[model samples]
Target: MRRLILLRHAKSDRPLGIVDLDRPLNDRGKRAAPQMGAYLAAEGLIPEAVVVSPAKRTRETWEAIQSALTGPEAEVVPSIYEAPEAALLSIVQTTPDTAGSLLMIGHNPGLQDLAMRLAGSGEKAGRKRLSLEFPTAAVVVLDFEGDAWSTVAAGTGRLERFVAPRDIKIGD
Candidate 1:
């Protein structure tokens, strides 16, 4: 089984002079990113490879998360920045087969759509929550039956987990 983790970029600060791609994560995002990382570690959901968007906030989110985890090869692909669902799908399909678990840190609409499209079966509650909105600093874990990443297609995955920063209780 192959696991795919889709993480939305954390909350960002929209500074007046900065372009959308250049926006940095806000204080809340800074806090949430690590919290999410800790949650991932606690749940034993480490990935073998990580794919990220080149945007500032997405990169920063990955950096914070990387601090809590170990030994995942990562790359920042420019195409993932504001990419459409089809473009994101293409990127995932081409991922090396050696990596059993793949994590992607990117922006919304695309990420949300990809998660919804790929998940054909899973817990009803998780799917219901996913349909509402994919919040910032949230993660959706999907398990695909096939071994090869190239064969992964829409409606072939089962939504294993859906976690958001709000769902995490850090100090507990």
Candidate 2:
């Protein structure tokens, strides 16, 4: 089985004069990003590679979580910045088969849609939650039955877990 972690970039500060792609994370987002990473680490869901968007906020979010990630493999892909769901899907499909797990840190709408499309029947509640909106610092874990990322398809993966910043803090 291959695991895919869909992570939405943490809350970003509104760009006053800052360009949309250059806006950094707000304080809350900064705090939440690492917490989410720690939670994932504690739960033993480590990814072999972390694929991230090159936007400022996404890069900062990844930096916040860097400490919690066990391995040293991470790639900042410019294509992920403002990418549509199709682009995101393409990136996932092209990932090497040897990598058992992947973590994609990117933006909303696309990420949310991808999660809903891949989720299994048992995760109806989580799917419903995702259908609303993907909040900042949210992580959804999906388990694809096939060994290769290219074989992933709609409804073929089960939603193993879903964690949002608020839920993590409440559990703490």
Number of the top lDDT candidate: 1
Question: What lDDT would candidate 1 get against the real structure?
Answer: 0.93
- Give the top-scoring candidate (TM-score): 1
lDDT (tens digit, per residue) of candidate 2 on 106-133: 9988898788877865467887888887
Q: At residue 154, give the lDDT of candidate 2.
A: 78
How much does candidate 2 score in TM-score? 0.95
Assess each prediction's global lDDT (C-alpha) against the native. Answer: 0.93, 0.87
Tens-digit per-residue lDDT, 100-128, candidate 1: 99999998999999999999999999999
